[model samples]
Target: MLPKHDVCGEPLYTPKIIFKEQGETKYETTDPYVWCRKCKKYVEVEVTQK
Candidate 1:
């Protein structure tokens, strides 16, 4: 099941992951929001970072 937006009650999507290289290590990053087609804006969702 997909998460719902707090304001719009729309289904939230998983944010994309980006990788970056710093020195000799790889780092990960992602957006804190999900895309909403109806709202046309990113909606914040619960996420756990590792």
Candidate 2:
């Protein structure tokens, strides 16, 4: 199920995976998430590995 906005109680949209480079190592890291149109932000929905 999709996550709901805390303030607006609206459903969030699942987009592309978000990734971040850690240190000098080229490892990409991120968590599973959803995008809130109402809040205009990405909200984490599940834990993920680096």
Candidate 3:
């Protein structure tokens, strides 16, 4: 079961993942999970180095 909403106090479903990376730096964020509308889940990833 999903965790209760942080505010509403109900099961909340999130379906999205975002990734930001550059050269050697990488950042990833996700909202639980969900089925991809086309093939598999979709996420935006960016890579950059400092």
Better-scoring candidate (lDDT), 1 or 3 = 1
Q: Which tens-of-lDDT digit does each residue in 1-50 have in candidate 3?
A: 54343334444345455888888988886644433334334333222222
Residue-level lDDT of model 2, residues 1-50, one tens digit each, is 65566778888664455556677656444446777778787776654333
**Residue 4 displacement (Å), model 3:** 1.3
Residue 26 miss distance in model 3 (angstroms)? 2.7
Quote the lDDT for 42 in model 2. 74
RMSD per model, one decimal = 1.9, 4.8, 10.3
As for TM-score, the candidate ahead, 1 or 3, is 1
Model 1: per-residue Cα lDDT over 1-50, one tens digit each: 77788777888888888889999999988877789977998877778764
lDDT of 3 at 28: 81
When 2 and 3 are scored with lDDT, the better candidate is: 2
User: What lDDT does the true structure give each of the candidates?
Assistant: 0.81, 0.63, 0.46
Model 3 ranges off by over 4 Å = 6-8, 30-50
Candidate 1 vs candidate 2: which has greater lDDT?
Answer: 1
